[model samples]
Target: MDLNRVVIVGASLAGLRAAETLRNEGFDGEVVVVGAEPHRPYDRPPLSKKLLAGEWEPDRIHLRQPDTFDDLDVEWRFGVAGAGLDPSAGILHLTNGTDITYDGCIIATGAACRRLPEQSRYSHVHEVRTLDDAMRLRAEIADGGRHVVVIGAGFIGLEVAATARQLGNDVTVLEGAPAPLIRGLGEEMGAAIGAMHEARGVTLRCGVQVDRLHDDGVLLAGEDGAEGELIEADIVVVGIGVVPATAWLGDSGLQLRDGVVCDETLNALDVDGSVVPGVYAAGDVLRWPNPLFAEEMRVEHWTNAAEQGAAAAKNLLAAAGRGAGAPEAYAPVPFFWSDQFDIRIQFLGRASADDAVEVVLGSTQPNEDGTVKFLALYRTGDRVHGALGVNAPRWVMKMRGQLMEQASWHDALAHAATLA
Candidate 1:
């Protein structure tokens, strides 16, 4: 197949890596990078941590330096969002009324922050999904004397609450679920993590339903939209969750469930459940079957995005017969880390709430230094399926190999017994 121009629909972490991989993998075609943001790609993890806390400036988070952009030999369409797509016509339509026809396309558009209805009406309400969003929220909380009400008790929400409390602000976190992260880490672990906030002087409210934002703060949803208690706040940050960026592909005929569905090879599937040739996807926007875990997953972690982007690019090249080796399956052990207060939490693998969880090492309580140190393993059937560690980097990371090899549940527990 003759490859000429390849268009990348996102100028994100995944998209940036894809462009780099294409040039490194001997794809000399014209590479065009599309970005909805005018600024260059930057790391997002720090947006909620150091950046929001005013410890790190915007420039420190850039994924690459200035001169590195010129080295890629690619055309960048900044400040232009993908408005539509016609996969059959090999065309990507931008919001600026411009269209580009490409030989191949990589969709790494990522996801959008989900907000409550009429969220944009209030000046105090904000969510951090981009550098601009973080900057705005940072300025609001920089003084740190006012009450900071954070809606949702997820990772982002809790991180922001911790940062706010650290800055001498009165912080309150509200969760609609019975417990924070109950869907991901189970009720017991979720409540365990939630306790960290309460210990640090942050008000943690779970099982609270949010009706809407008022001038005072978050209004609790009452019976049939009746009046309810208003949680007053000087500043409000909403971090409920995100939805995959797939509206641009609404008419593109690509299969969009929770995300873009792909095969084991990361090739985008059409609505009819067939691979759409020359179309590849990665990052939070794409979900593909993993032979390792025997399931399909769309990982939102930065590590997965960075790795999958490179894999997708290489796979696309190999599919077009423009690479050195055959197309390899892009299956990875999804991993992500979070820092809240003084505890560092790291999680790996795909674990369900129903999976039997056991603390393999250390206790789930705070250590002598007032920091958490423990490793919890998720077992399903006969296999050790997932692992989560709190302030136990080495012990937690050691489980990666065990997970990759599909180690037996009892054998994994046996290995941990020796560490004690």
Candidate 2:
């Protein structure tokens, strides 16, 4: 089979890695990468942790060196947004009124941060999804003595709060849930995190609803639905979460529910045929079936993007063979970590399913360094769907490997205990 031109949308972690992998796989074709953002792909995790604390510089957040792409002969089209796709015509329409033809394509467009309500003044409001967002928020915190109000208790929100606290700024976290990370870590772990934050000087207000936002403060409604109370803040940072960036593919005929639907081989369902297939999707913009998870889920994590991007690239090369021998599959254990108040909180597996969980490791302490927290969530059978660790990278890493190996919950717990 002859090599074909590949166009990748969204120069994200997944897109970049995919392009590099194609070149490494000896695909000598015209590779073009288009990015909506002005800056190249950077490490987003550092944006909330180190960037907020002024530790890592924004310019240095790039995933690759400046000359890496040039060496790989990859053409980059920065600041250009992919408007839509015409699979029948084998063309990609751009926002700038230009159409580019591609033998294959990969859509790695990731998610963006959700904006606050319209009534709230966005001038003083901040977000940390991008480098610019992090820089703006970091400057405000570096200026000294600014009351930072985090409007969520997710990983990003908590990390920003922890960074703000470290920068000598008063931090207050407003979580709409009953406890911090309740939806993700269950009630027990969420309560443990809340207690840890409170012990570390963070004003965590859980189970409260924000009624409205004012110039001076936020009007919050208590759990009892009484009169709202005003909580004054200087700079408000919102980290509620994000949605997939697939607005442009509305009329593209691609099966998009939460993201671009794909098969196990990561092939875009729309352009199933065609020698020069014009469309494929990956990263946060992809909602593909996972043989490991036993369900179709959309993931916005960094590793997911990178792994899926590479998979899509390889599949594009093997399109003629009908995606045969594609080694890259979306079977990740689904892991994510956050650094807050000197405590490194790491999660392995999905924490959304577990109801009654048991703590088999480290005590619930915020400052617990190098400690592991093995949470066993058992409903019927002995199944450990999730595991949380504080400053315990090795434990989480081990659990992730076990999950990948399809280890049983009973065996995993017994093995984890031996390590403990």
Q: Which candidate leads the pack in lDDT? A: 1
The worst-scoring run of ten residues by lDDT in candidate 1 lies at 181-190
lDDT of 1 by residue, 252-343 (tens): 99999999999998999999999999999989999899999998788888999999899889989998999878888887888999888887
Q: Which lDDT value does model 2 have at 93?
A: 94
What overall lDDT, based on C-alpha atoms, would model 2 receive against the true structure?
A: 0.77
Misplaced by over 4 Å in model 2 are 1-3, 222-227, 271-278, 321-328, 365-380
Global CA lDDT of candidate 1, please? 0.90
What TM-score does candidate 2 get on C-alpha atoms?
0.91
lDDT of 2 by residue, 1-420 (tens): 344778889888998988998888788878999999898878888988887788889776889888876798988998899899876666889999998887788889888777667734557788888888888888789966889899999888988888898888898999888888776677778788777777778999988788867787677975566768888999888888888888998877777777888877787775343222446678888887788867687877777787888878888777644344743555777777777876777777776643457666655643345333444432224555666776677766767666666666777778678667
